[model samples]
Target: MNEQLIHSKITSMEIDVLRAVKQRTLEKFTEGPSVERARLFFLLLPYFDGKHWSGEIEASAKTVSIVYAALHAHDQVKENASATKKQQLTVLAGDFYSGIYYQMLANLNNITMIQRLATAIIKVSEKKASFHDGLDRTTAELDRSVQQIETELLATFYNFYGFDHYTPLATLMLSYIRYKDELECLQGGSETRIIRSLNETLQHPLHTERWLLEKLDNLHDQISLTINSYNFNYDLKNFMLHQITPHQHRAEQLTREG
Candidate 1:
């Protein structure tokens, strides 16, 4: 099948995912369902490239993206103990998304991917917890954990369908995107677990910024190499490259005479 057909199938599944996870309270309080098109495109890339594709496979892929959105919503939850109602619902949003993914997979009878993704989530959570543990972690270890958190769910889906070719590029690109956001949070004077852990190790926020810049540069190089390893067409490769990395941030403007 062609790319358009693959994308259509994935989109249909995504609609179902949103329907499955819809809740009155969540719809009212938390941010609405975040069915990111970029992630859906990547999830369906293997199918789009003329690999072994099926309705069940597409369904599983949609669930995988939902899992990502779920975890991403939780990541937005403030570390503040005095979280407001919206923030509390944001925490439940992740858990609710997790339930939707589980139920969708069960309906598909693809128990194997469910197990695999669950295991991947466990590892991701453990790595996230490590950052909260008051221990200094080396830059390399921190990078690895961030990577696993960024790509493990998608990688689990890919690996299940023998589509491991995209894991390296996805891992590099996703992790780079994550660190970019963290850098913005740091500049905005907010705290992230990774940034907090990095501050502990580096002993200053400036050092944290330096470390993130170096990490983003290195990930860009790695992403370039990993993309070359894939047998994707020029258009597909160009789309992923232009859209994913090397991601650039817009310059901030300030009124000096104010």
Candidate 2:
């Protein structure tokens, strides 16, 4: 599929996921969901490739997206002394989305997927908690945790439906997108948990930034090679290059100007 079609499909799935989990009070008070476009693109990638897509599969995909949003909401909670209203509601929002995902899967009689995803969530939460528990991790250990934090859910979904072929590319691309944003946050001095943890792990913010930039470059090369290794068409490859993984946001900016 072309990028336009892929984007439209993802937007529609996103709207459905949002509506399924929407609550008026949460919408009025909280920072809504953090559904990233990159995750959605990977969730819909098998379908975009004209694979074994059905309404049930699409519903399952949406549930995975909701699960991502749910976990992402809780990750926003700071480590210490945050009793703010937003913090309180953010906790509830995460729980609420978790429940919605369970119920959605139950409705489809997908108890197996629910079980698998629950396991994935457990692994993810353990890695997330490792940060706060003050476990002294080396840079390599931290990188492993970050990969699970970013790709476990999507990998579970793909593995469930024989779409596991895309796992490597999806993991690399999504992790790249995350570090890209983390680099921006470092430059902006935002001090997210990932940044703070990485700074401590790397012993300096500048080292963390350099590590991130190097990882992004390495992942870009891996993604380029992996995408070509697949039998995807030119349009899909173009979308992966220009839309999914590029040299940097600078490449995207120059493309727009040209």
Error of 1 at 36 (Å): 3.5
**Cα RMSDs, all models:** 4.0, 3.1
TM-scores, in order shown?
Answer: 0.86, 0.93
Model 2, residue 256: distance off in Å is 17
lDDT of 2 by residue, 1-258 (tens): 777888898789888989999998788778998888878889989988789799998999999999999999988887796598889999999999999999999999999999999999999999888788777788888888889999999999999999999998888888888888888899898887788889998999989987887888788888888888988888888988888767664445447869
Overall lDDT per candidate, in order of appearance? 0.80, 0.88
Which pairs of residues clash in candidate 2, taking residues 3 or more apart in a chain or in different chains?
A: none
Number of the top-ranking candidate, with lDDT as the measure: 2
Q: Write one digit per residue (lDDT tens) for candidate 1, span 89-178.
A: 989899889988898898988888889998988988898888888777888888888888878888988888888888877788888888
Q: Lowest lDDT 10-mer window, candidate 2?
A: 245-254
